[model samples]
Target: MNIIEVEDLTTTYNGHTAIKNISFKIEKGEYVCLIGENGSGKSTLIKTIVGINKKDSGKIIKNIPPEKISYLAQNNMIDLNFPATGKEIIMTGVQKHKCLPFYKKEDYKKFADVCKLLNIEDIINKQISDLSGGQRQRIMLARALIRKPDLLILDEPCSGLDVNITKELYNILNKLNKEDGLTIIMATHDLEEIKTIGVRVICLATTVKFDGDIKDWKGEM
Candidate 1:
């Protein structure tokens, strides 16, 4: 099943087109790596797909509910000195309910499951200011996962981390896709980081440059 489909999509801002004639479809349980150079409309296309940016034209057909599709942006904009525990910040990702009083047993269970999945249960209690970049990233990932999303969309999720941590994050994502069958569309700069992870590659340069199995992508890196 096609979880996401974009055909001839276009997005422009201030008369400058960020992405044009973009098209692709993500399968229900497939992991897709979206690759492109800087200023290649990768972010724009991702934002458009997640309804963060308005498209100029074309079509986007999403098979899942909008609320069930979780998105992680390229940047982490949280204040380090916010004086909140990592877990508190992640709790904000849970949608508010009229009858549900803040955090319920099921909510904490979901939190525990998400934390265990990301292997961050040890650090979630630390203050945000004292956490490392990798920890913070994991918290963000946990927040995104707390909703148990059917489709996960991430844009350059590992931007500032070192090599080992990036590898760890990749391993977690790989496990999620391969084991849990979570459909994912991730935008990234380093194709080689995920090139061998059994994922389809979608290259965009303000448009569709290449779309196929990663082994079949012929572009020179």
Candidate 2:
């Protein structure tokens, strides 16, 4: 099943074309990576996909509900002093309109499961500002997964993590994808990490430069 379809998509900023006439389709349960050099419109394309920016032309067809599409931004924008605990931050993934005096039992169970899976249960009560960069990223990921999103859109998920921590995070993501069949769409510059995940490759150089099996992508680094 095609979860997302983009045809003839175009976006421009200040009279400068960011992405020109790009097109692609993402199938259900498929892990795909978007790769390109700096200024290649990768971020612009992601913003357009998630409706943060309006497309200049063409259409996008998303089979999943808009709320089911969870985007884990590269850098979280929440204020460190917001006074929300790690668990509280994760609970926000539940629908905002749903009125509830407290998180339901099921919600707590899911949150616990995610924290365990991410190996962050020990820090559930800690403040977000007190955690390391890697821990913060993992918490954000747990928050993303708490919603049980069908499609996970991440931008530079391992951007600043150390080598071992990066490997650990991807290991968790790999387990999630394999065990739950989650569909993942990530924009990353980590070519080595991409090879480790072994997913389909989508290269964007101001447009759709390549899209096919990962084994077929022989572009130079």
Q: Candidate 2's error at 195, in angstroms?
A: 0.9
- Model 2, span 1-221: residue lDDT tens: 99999999999966799999988999999998889998788888888898888889989899999778888877455576667789888888875556765878888888888888888989979998898878888888988998888999888788777888888877887777788999988888888876977998789888888998778898863
Candidate 2 runs further than 4 Å off: 99-101
lDDT of 1: 0.85
Candidate 1 residues lying further than 4 Å off, grouped into runs, are 96-101
- The pairs that clash in candidate 2 are none
lDDT of 1 by residue, 66-169 (tens): 76889887546667788989898788777644245478788899999998888898999899889988888889899898988889999999898878888988
Determine which window of 10 residues in candidate 1 has minimal summed lDDT.
93-102
